[model samples]
Target: MLVTALTKLLNIRIPIIQGGMQWVGLPQLAAAVSNSGGLGILTALTQPDPNALRLAIRETRKLTPKPFGVNITLLPTINPPDYEGYARAALEEGVMIFETAGNNPAHLVKSFKDHGCIVIHKCTNIRHAKSAARLGVDVLSIDGFECAGHGGEEDIGGLVLLAKAAQELDIPYIASGGIATGRGLAAALALGAAGANIGTRFLCTVESPIHQSIKDKIVASKEQDTVHIFRTLRNTARVYRNTVSEQVIALESLPGGARFDELRDLVSGQRGRRVFETGDPDYGIWSAGVALGLINDCPTCEELLRRMEREAEEAIKGMAELVQG
Candidate 1:
C-alpha cells in the first residue's frame, strides 16, 4: 500500500501515526512504533524537563534509527518548566517531525520550520484543523470526538468531519476517531482522507506503554463504552467509563472539583508512571478510544502494521475484482 502524505512527509513506510499521548507516549513506545514503520510521537512534556526529553530521545535513538517526532500539547499542564526548552531539545536532538495539539503553534511552527522540520498538529474540530493548516503545518491530524484524550465536544463523527474538512481545506488531512481496521482505513480514503490515525486500537498493542490491565479493559469495551467529561469548560475529553471516570463525571456535574488535575491525585504521576512502566492496570485510569472494541490482541507494532497493510491491500483488491466483475 502507498503511504499517506504524513508518512511521506515523515519519511515512514506506514500511514499510521502514533497519537502523542501524555504518560503513554514514552521514548520506548515512540521508538517501537517508529521502528515498526509507523511514526511514533514522543510526548514533549512527557518528562519533567528538556533534559529528560533529550534523554528519552537519545534512548529512543539508541533503540532505533527510524524517524520519530515530539508531541507538544499546548494545554494546561504542570511539567515543562520551559516548553521551548523541550522544543529546543527536540530540535537539537535532530527530531525532524513535530506533532502539536491545542492552541496556535505559530512560534514553535516558525522555529521548527526554520530547522527543516515537518509539523503535524492534532485538531479535534474543523476550525482547529483549518487554523493549523493556515499555520502552514505539514499535516492536519483530524481528531474527531471519537478519539481518546481531549476530544472536542462536537458531535461530528469522522464520517461527517472528514468530508467537511475536504470541503473547506485543500490541505492533506487524515481521519482519526473510531478507526481500528483496514475497513476504517478504506472508509477514510473513500471519505477523501489520505490516511487514518489510530489511538485506542494501537494502545491495546504490546508495543504500547499502557498497562495490560487497562488494555484488557479496552479489549472488553464496546463502541459505546466511552463517555465525554469536562465538556462544560470546552476542555472535554473522552474517557473510558471506569469507576474513577464516573466519579470525575459526577463531581463535574455538581461543581465540586472539575479540573483535570482533580483526578490527578487519584491517578497521580507516581501511580500512573508505575502503572505504565510496570503494566499494572489497577494503579491508574488511562485514556482510551471507543475503537477499543476492534482491538483483540497485543501484537508487536511491526506485526500490526504489516498485517493492517496486507489486509487493506487484500480488501481493496477484492473490491476491485467485484467492480470488474
Candidate 2:
C-alpha cells in the first residue's frame, strides 16, 4: 500500500486524484474513481446552477459512499456564476474536500475552512503554490506546462516543476500534467509529491461521460497531438491538435492576433461540450494533455487504478534493487 499524506487526509486508499475536467466530470465518473479507492472530483461549474450542483452531489453519493471532492474553478468569464452559492451548495451536501483552481480563492478559503472542508488549490508554479500555502489551504496540486487546462505561461514540465515544489513548499502537493502511467506516479512520489492529479487519462476511462469516439481519438493520438493556445491573451491552455485548435494557434501567430474576441467562437466551452456529446473531435477546442499518448485502452476506473497500483509497486521495487545491487 502506497500511503501518503494525501491518501490519509482524504481517507482514500490511493493517492491518485481525478482532475476535475469541465463537462467531463459528472457523477458517474467521479463515483467510479472514488469507488476504486482514488479521490474523485465533480466539477461544480458543470452544473447549471447551485441547486443542480446539490442534486449532482447527491447523485454521486447514491453511486458511491467513498469520499470524493468538488472542483470550484474561478476562471474569468463575462458573467460568472455565483461561486459562493456553489460552495454553499457543496457544503450543504456535506462535501468535505474542495479542489480550487484557475484563480486564487483567497476570498473563499476561510469560508471553506470554517465548514471543516479541506481545500486543495491547483497551481502551475512555485510562486502560486507559495501563495496558496499562505492562504492555509490543506494541499496544493502543482500543474505543469503539459496540463490540459490553464497551464500558466511557464513552460516547465513535471520533472522540474515537482522538484522545485519539493524544495520550496511547506505543504504537501500532488504532481499534475503529463501524468498517466504507473511509472509517472512513481516518479512523482520520488520527486516528493504526495500524489498524482490526472486529467486526460481519466477522460478515456469507461466510466467517463465523454463519447466513445472521443476516447478512441485520444488512444490513437501521440504526445505531439496536443498544441498550446491563448498565449498572447496571457491565458494559456493545452488542447488536442484538432482543426479548431490549429486554427486558433495559427490566428494567434498573425500580426493582429492578440485579442480573445477574434477567436471566441472557435474556442468557446459550449462548443467543446458539444464535441463531448457528439463524439466529434473536430467540433471545437477540448482540453487534453500530452498524456493522451500514454493511454492505449479504455479500461474501467477500477481496472485502471488496480493496474497502476501494481505497476507502481513493481517500479519502486526495481529502483530499490538497483540501489542495493
Candidate 3:
C-alpha cells in the first residue's frame, strides 16, 4: 500500500485524488473513486444551488462509505453562485474535506478549518502555493500548465513546477496536471508531493459520466492534442483540441484580441455539457489535460486503481534497485 501524508491525513488507501471537474464530478464518479481508495471530489457549483449540492453530497454517501470531498471553485463570474450557501450545505451534510480552486480562498479557509474540515487548495504556481499555505490550508494541489481548465497564465509544467514547490513550500502538496499512471504517482512522491491529483485520466474511466465517444477520443489523443484558449484575455484554459477551440484561438489572435462576449456562445458551459451528453467531440469546448496522451483504456475505477497500485510498486521498486549503496 502506498502511503504518504495525504493518505494518512485523508485516510485513503492510495495517494490519488480525482479532480473535481465541472459537468463531470457527479456522485457516481466520486463514489467510485472513493470506493477504490482514492479521494473523489464533487463539484459544488455543478449543482444548481446549495440545496442541490446537499442532495448530491447525500447521494454520494449512499454510494460509498469512504471519505470524499467537495470542490468549491471561486471564479470571476458576473453572477456568481451562492458560495457560502454551498459551503454551509457541505458542512451540514458532514463533508470533512474540500478542494478549492480558481481564486484566493482566504474567505473560506478559516471557516472550513473551524468545522474540522481539511482544505486542499489548488494553485498554479509556487507563488500562489506559498500564498495559500500562508492562509493555513492543510494541503496544496499544485497544478501545472498542462492541466485542464484554468492552468493560470504562468505556463509552468509539472516537472519544474512540482520540484519548485518541493523546494519552497513547507506544507504538503499533491501534484496535479498530466498525471495518469502509477509511475506518475511514484514520481510525485519522489518530488516530495504527498499525492497526485488526476483529472483527464479519470475522465476516461468507465464510470465517468461523459459519453463514450469523448472517452474514446481521450484514449486516442496525443500529448499535443490539446490547445490553450482565452490566453488573450489573460484567463487561459487548457481544453481538448477541437474545431470549436481552434475557432476561439483564431478569434483571440485577431487584432486587439477577441473579448469574452465574442466567444461566449462558442464556449458556453451548456454546449460543453452537450458534448459530454451527446458523445460529440466537436460539439463544444471541453477540458482535457496533456495526460490524455498516456490514457489508453476506459477501465472501471476499481480496475484502474488496482492497476495503478501495481504499476506504482513496480516503478518504485525498480528505482530502488538503481541505488549504488
Better of 1 and 3 by TM-score: 3
Q: What's the lDDT for candidate 1?
A: 0.79
Task: lDDT winner between 2 and 3, please give it.
Answer: 3
RMSD of 1: 2.4
The residue pairs found clashing in candidate 1 are none
What would the per-residue lDDT of candidate 3 be over residues 1-325, giving only the tens digit for each residue? 8889999999999999999999999999999999999999999989999999999999999999999999999989898889999999999999999999988889889889999889999999999899999999999999988889999998888989999998899999999998899999899889889999999999999899999989888888999999999999999999999999999999999999999999999999999999999999999999999898899999999999999988999999999999986
lDDT of 1 by residue, 11-62 (tens): 7887888888878788778888888888888887778888999999999899
For model 2, residues 1-325, the per-residue Cα lDDT tens digits are: 9999999899999889999999988999999999999999999999999999999999999999999999999989888889999999999889999999987799888899998889999999999999999999999999998889899898998899999999999989999998898888999999999999999999999999999999999999999999889988888889889999999999999996758888999999899999999999999999999998899999999999999988888898998888852
Q: Give the TM-score of candidate 1.
A: 0.91
Model 3 residue 34 CA deviation (Å) reads 0.5
- If scored against the real structure, what TM-score would every candidate get? 0.91, 0.99, 0.99
The residue ranges of model 2 lying beyond 4 angstroms of the native Cα positions read none
Local distance difference test, candidate 2: 0.93
Model 1: residues with Cα > 4 Å off, grouped in runs: 77-81, 255-283, 322-325
